[model samples]
Target: MLDALRIEIVEVSNEKVVARCPFMMQPDNTLDSFMGSFNSETVASVGSWNLLDMENEYAIGLEISANHIRGESEGTVKATGFPIHKTTMVWEIQITDENDKPICFSRCTTAVNKRIKKNNS
Candidate 1:
């Protein structure tokens, strides 16, 4: 059963991945069971999620603002290579296996965009 469950951070963006969840999403619902059964910090595994090259090629940069994030959070956001911002953020999870080796890693890339465009006028 354990062998059936494995985690890895796959780009899974655009043509990167044609499918979802390298592992099964549903698990036996028990007191210990969770939508995410990771045993480590969620951010430990993920590093950063960045804009696609195609995205960066368009404009000088995204007009990131508070609306770019869900809710009114002003926390630090980051892209894979970018230092930090509020438009795009990264979430990573790390889990160790019975052999005490780093086995599972999962990350999610979520973006927030400005609802309105601010004009310099």
Candidate 2:
């Protein structure tokens, strides 16, 4: 889905992760605006990627809520995820837009999962 939306990961660190996407309108429309689902996905992607980078463990999104404040019809939109709180196996993430605006602020709860080894039988 990231490939289809052209979402790109621009940065990652212990504190935050950033993702970018260019504004693209629907085929039959000229709005050039993105859907709320896209904004939600961007938040989850950055949040999940941050956990993976920090812990070296796969993180599964357990819950997410996105509040879209505004929409853009031009320019690129960037989503940055910050770890506001965390437990041993879960993280609470907050996301903001490129202009430091609240495009779609979200809270994501992710659970760290262990990768299972496959048996080559």
Instruction: Report the C-alpha lDDT of model 2 over 35-70, residue by residue, as the tens digit.
Output: 444555456556666556443467666776666556
Instruction: Assess each prediction's global lDDT (C-alpha) against the native.
Output: 0.28, 0.58
**Cα misplacement distance, residue 22 of candidate 1 (Å):** 23
Model 2 score (lDDT)? 0.58
Regions of model 2 farther than 4 Å from truth: 24-56, 88-98, 114-121
Candidate 1 lDDT by residue in tens digits, 9-119? 433332122111222222331212231333221222222222334333221222221111111112111122112332354334333323323333344434544345467
Worst 10 residues of 1 by lDDT: 65-74
TM-score attained by model 2: 0.64
**Poorly placed runs, candidate 1 (over 4 Å):** 1-34, 37-87, 97-103, 115-121
